[model samples]
Target: MSVGVRRVAKGVGDFVIEALGEAVGEFVLSLLACALLGCLVLVAYLAWSFSPRLTIAGAGVLGLLLAHGAWQTFRTSTKGRRRGLATLTAAAFGATAITAIFLLLYGTGCDCW
Candidate 1:
Protein backbone atom coordinates (compact mmCIF):
# COMPACT_ATOMS: atom_id res chain seq x y z
CA MET A 1 0.00 0.00 0.00
CA SER A 2 1.00 3.64 -0.51
CA VAL A 3 2.28 5.72 2.45
CA GLY A 4 -0.99 7.71 2.68
CA VAL A 5 -3.10 4.59 2.56
CA ARG A 6 -0.98 2.94 5.27
CA ARG A 7 -1.40 5.97 7.52
CA VAL A 8 -5.17 5.96 7.04
CA ALA A 9 -5.38 2.27 7.78
CA LYS A 10 -3.32 2.72 10.95
CA GLY A 11 -5.60 5.54 12.10
CA VAL A 12 -8.67 3.41 11.50
CA GLY A 13 -7.11 0.51 13.38
CA ASP A 14 -6.33 2.76 16.37
CA PHE A 15 -9.89 4.08 16.42
CA VAL A 16 -11.33 0.58 16.36
CA ILE A 17 -9.06 -0.52 19.21
CA GLU A 18 -10.04 2.47 21.33
CA ALA A 19 -13.73 1.83 20.76
CA LEU A 20 -13.39 -1.84 21.58
CA GLY A 21 -11.51 -1.04 24.77
CA GLU A 22 -14.27 1.31 25.90
CA ALA A 23 -16.90 -1.31 25.16
CA VAL A 24 -15.05 -3.94 27.16
CA GLY A 25 -14.61 -1.55 30.09
CA GLU A 26 -18.31 -0.80 30.13
CA PHE A 27 -19.19 -4.49 30.01
CA VAL A 28 -16.85 -5.26 32.91
CA LEU A 29 -18.33 -2.47 34.99
CA SER A 30 -21.85 -3.73 34.34
CA LEU A 31 -20.88 -7.26 35.33
CA LEU A 32 -19.28 -6.04 38.56
CA ALA A 33 -22.39 -4.06 39.47
CA CYS A 34 -24.56 -7.13 38.95
CA ALA A 35 -22.24 -9.28 41.03
CA LEU A 36 -22.26 -6.77 43.86
CA LEU A 37 -26.04 -6.71 43.85
CA GLY A 38 -26.13 -10.50 43.98
CA CYS A 39 -23.77 -10.50 46.96
CA LEU A 40 -26.02 -8.00 48.75
CA VAL A 41 -29.00 -10.28 48.22
CA LEU A 42 -27.09 -13.26 49.52
CA VAL A 43 -26.06 -11.41 52.67
CA ALA A 44 -29.66 -10.31 53.24
CA TYR A 45 -30.84 -13.89 52.95
CA LEU A 46 -28.28 -15.08 55.46
CA ALA A 47 -29.34 -12.37 57.88
CA TRP A 48 -32.95 -13.35 57.46
CA SER A 49 -32.23 -17.00 58.08
CA PHE A 50 -30.26 -16.21 61.23
CA SER A 51 -32.80 -13.91 62.89
CA PRO A 52 -35.98 -11.97 62.09
CA ARG A 53 -34.69 -8.84 63.76
CA LEU A 54 -31.50 -9.06 61.78
CA THR A 55 -33.52 -9.50 58.65
CA ILE A 56 -35.47 -6.30 59.30
CA ALA A 57 -32.33 -4.39 60.07
CA GLY A 58 -30.52 -5.79 57.07
CA ALA A 59 -33.42 -4.82 54.85
CA GLY A 60 -33.40 -1.29 56.20
CA VAL A 61 -29.65 -0.97 55.60
CA LEU A 62 -29.96 -2.47 52.13
CA GLY A 63 -32.78 -0.07 51.28
CA LEU A 64 -30.67 2.89 52.34
CA LEU A 65 -27.69 1.65 50.35
CA LEU A 66 -29.84 1.09 47.29
CA ALA A 67 -31.36 4.55 47.56
CA HIS A 68 -27.93 6.13 47.89
CA GLY A 69 -26.54 4.15 44.98
CA ALA A 70 -29.50 5.08 42.81
CA TRP A 71 -29.14 8.74 43.69
CA GLN A 72 -25.43 8.70 42.87
CA THR A 73 -26.09 6.93 39.63
CA PHE A 74 -28.68 9.55 38.73
CA ARG A 75 -26.31 12.39 39.51
CA THR A 76 -23.49 10.84 37.51
CA SER A 77 -25.76 10.13 34.59
CA THR A 78 -27.08 13.66 34.53
CA LYS A 79 -23.73 15.36 34.87
CA GLY A 80 -21.95 13.03 32.48
CA ARG A 81 -24.80 13.48 29.94
CA ARG A 82 -25.26 9.80 29.32
CA ARG A 83 -28.72 8.59 28.33
CA GLY A 84 -27.81 4.95 28.81
CA LEU A 85 -26.60 5.61 32.36
CA ALA A 86 -29.81 7.46 33.11
CA THR A 87 -31.82 4.50 31.91
CA LEU A 88 -29.76 2.14 34.05
CA THR A 89 -30.30 4.34 37.07
CA ALA A 90 -34.04 4.32 36.50
CA ALA A 91 -34.02 0.55 36.32
CA ALA A 92 -31.98 0.35 39.52
CA PHE A 93 -34.51 2.55 41.28
CA GLY A 94 -37.36 0.35 40.13
CA ALA A 95 -35.56 -2.77 41.26
CA THR A 96 -34.87 -1.20 44.65
CA ALA A 97 -38.56 -0.44 45.10
CA ILE A 98 -39.53 -3.99 44.21
CA THR A 99 -36.91 -5.45 46.53
CA ALA A 100 -38.11 -3.26 49.40
CA ILE A 101 -41.65 -4.51 48.92
CA PHE A 102 -40.51 -8.13 48.98
CA LEU A 103 -38.41 -7.58 52.10
CA LEU A 104 -41.35 -5.99 53.90
CA LEU A 105 -43.58 -8.92 53.03
CA TYR A 106 -40.94 -11.40 54.08
CA GLY A 107 -40.36 -9.64 57.40
CA THR A 108 -44.03 -9.88 58.27
CA GLY A 109 -44.01 -13.64 57.84
CA CYS A 110 -40.85 -14.34 59.86
CA ASP A 111 -41.36 -15.74 63.37
CA CYS A 112 -37.75 -16.34 64.33
CA TRP A 113 -36.71 -15.37 67.80
Candidate 2:
Protein backbone atom coordinates (compact mmCIF):
# COMPACT_ATOMS: atom_id res chain seq x y z
CA MET A 1 0.00 0.00 0.00
CA SER A 2 1.04 3.63 -0.55
CA VAL A 3 2.52 5.55 2.42
CA GLY A 4 -0.22 8.16 2.07
CA VAL A 5 -2.88 5.48 2.25
CA ARG A 6 -1.16 3.94 5.27
CA ARG A 7 -1.04 7.32 6.99
CA VAL A 8 -4.74 7.89 6.43
CA ALA A 9 -5.63 4.41 7.64
CA LYS A 10 -3.54 4.85 10.80
CA GLY A 11 -5.10 8.23 11.51
CA VAL A 12 -8.62 6.88 11.05
CA GLY A 13 -7.87 3.96 13.33
CA ASP A 14 -6.49 6.28 16.02
CA PHE A 15 -9.44 8.62 15.82
CA VAL A 16 -11.99 5.87 15.99
CA ILE A 17 -10.29 4.29 19.01
CA GLU A 18 -10.08 7.54 20.91
CA ALA A 19 -13.64 8.48 20.08
CA LEU A 20 -14.99 5.14 21.19
CA GLY A 21 -12.94 5.18 24.36
CA GLU A 22 -14.20 8.61 25.35
CA ALA A 23 -17.78 7.84 24.46
CA VAL A 24 -17.85 4.50 26.21
CA GLY A 25 -15.85 5.74 29.24
CA GLU A 26 -13.02 3.36 28.34
CA PHE A 27 -12.08 1.57 31.62
CA VAL A 28 -13.40 4.23 33.98
CA LEU A 29 -16.79 2.54 34.41
CA SER A 30 -15.14 -0.78 35.01
CA LEU A 31 -12.95 0.70 37.71
CA LEU A 32 -15.86 2.36 39.45
CA ALA A 33 -18.04 -0.75 39.31
CA CYS A 34 -15.26 -2.94 40.67
CA ALA A 35 -14.52 -0.47 43.41
CA LEU A 36 -18.16 -0.35 44.44
CA LEU A 37 -18.33 -4.13 44.51
CA GLY A 38 -15.19 -4.31 46.63
CA CYS A 39 -16.63 -1.84 49.05
CA LEU A 40 -19.84 -3.86 49.28
CA VAL A 41 -17.82 -6.92 50.18
CA LEU A 42 -15.88 -5.03 52.81
CA VAL A 43 -19.04 -3.60 54.29
CA ALA A 44 -20.65 -7.02 54.42
CA TYR A 45 -17.64 -8.35 56.26
CA LEU A 46 -17.71 -5.52 58.73
CA ALA A 47 -21.40 -5.99 59.36
CA TRP A 48 -20.88 -9.67 59.98
CA SER A 49 -17.82 -9.28 62.19
CA PHE A 50 -17.76 -6.02 64.07
CA SER A 51 -21.40 -5.08 64.49
CA PRO A 52 -24.80 -5.63 62.89
CA ARG A 53 -25.40 -1.91 62.86
CA LEU A 54 -23.29 -1.74 59.71
CA THR A 55 -25.98 -3.84 58.08
CA ILE A 56 -28.34 -0.87 58.31
CA ALA A 57 -25.84 1.27 56.45
CA GLY A 58 -25.35 -1.47 53.86
CA ALA A 59 -29.09 -1.71 53.31
CA GLY A 60 -29.36 2.01 52.67
CA VAL A 61 -26.47 2.08 50.21
CA LEU A 62 -27.67 -1.04 48.45
CA GLY A 63 -31.15 0.45 48.17
CA LEU A 64 -29.66 3.47 46.45
CA LEU A 65 -27.74 1.32 44.06
CA LEU A 66 -30.87 -0.68 43.33
CA ALA A 67 -32.81 2.48 42.59
CA HIS A 68 -30.10 3.76 40.27
CA GLY A 69 -30.16 0.45 38.43
CA ALA A 70 -33.89 0.65 38.03
CA TRP A 71 -33.64 4.19 36.73
CA GLN A 72 -30.99 3.25 34.19
CA THR A 73 -32.85 0.17 33.11
CA PHE A 74 -35.91 2.29 32.40
CA ARG A 75 -34.13 4.98 30.42
CA THR A 76 -35.22 5.24 26.78
CA SER A 77 -32.64 7.47 25.08
CA THR A 78 -29.41 5.63 25.67
CA LYS A 79 -27.12 5.09 22.67
CA GLY A 80 -26.73 1.36 23.22
CA ARG A 81 -28.20 -1.64 25.05
CA ARG A 82 -25.06 -1.97 27.13
CA ARG A 83 -26.27 0.71 29.50
CA GLY A 84 -29.42 -1.20 30.29
CA LEU A 85 -27.51 -4.42 30.68
CA ALA A 86 -25.04 -2.88 33.08
CA THR A 87 -27.83 -1.40 35.15
CA LEU A 88 -29.68 -4.69 35.24
CA THR A 89 -26.53 -6.38 36.45
CA ALA A 90 -26.11 -3.73 39.09
CA ALA A 91 -29.66 -4.27 40.23
CA ALA A 92 -28.98 -7.94 40.72
CA PHE A 93 -25.90 -7.19 42.76
CA GLY A 94 -27.78 -4.68 44.86
CA ALA A 95 -30.51 -7.18 45.58
CA THR A 96 -27.94 -9.75 46.63
CA ALA A 97 -26.29 -7.28 48.97
CA ILE A 98 -29.61 -6.35 50.47
CA THR A 99 -30.40 -9.99 51.04
CA ALA A 100 -27.11 -10.50 52.79
CA ILE A 101 -27.77 -7.55 55.04
CA PHE A 102 -31.17 -8.91 55.95
CA LEU A 103 -29.71 -12.30 56.73
CA LEU A 104 -27.15 -10.70 59.02
CA LEU A 105 -29.85 -8.74 60.74
CA TYR A 106 -31.91 -11.85 61.16
CA GLY A 107 -28.97 -13.67 62.69
CA THR A 108 -28.61 -10.81 65.14
CA GLY A 109 -32.33 -11.01 66.03
CA CYS A 110 -32.73 -7.44 64.82
CA ASP A 111 -34.64 -7.70 61.50
CA CYS A 112 -33.78 -4.14 60.76
CA TRP A 113 -34.64 -2.56 57.42
* RMSD of candidate 1 to true structure, Å: 13.5
The per-model lDDT (C-alpha) reads 0.68, 0.66
lDDT of 2 by residue, 1-113 (tens): 99999999999999999999886773454454555556767878877788677777777876777766766656674576555556675667667667566545433332222
TM-scores for every candidate against the unseen true structure: 0.49, 0.34
lDDT of 1 by residue, 67-90 (tens): 765776556453655465545655
Q: Which 10 consecutive residues of model 1 have the lowest summed lDDT?
A: 104-113
Residue 66 displacement in candidate 1 (angstroms): 12
RMSDs, each prediction?
Answer: 13.5, 14.4
| Count of residue pairs whose backbone atoms collide, per candidate | 0, 0
TM-score, cand. 1 vs. native? 0.49
Q: Give the TM-score of candidate 2.
A: 0.34
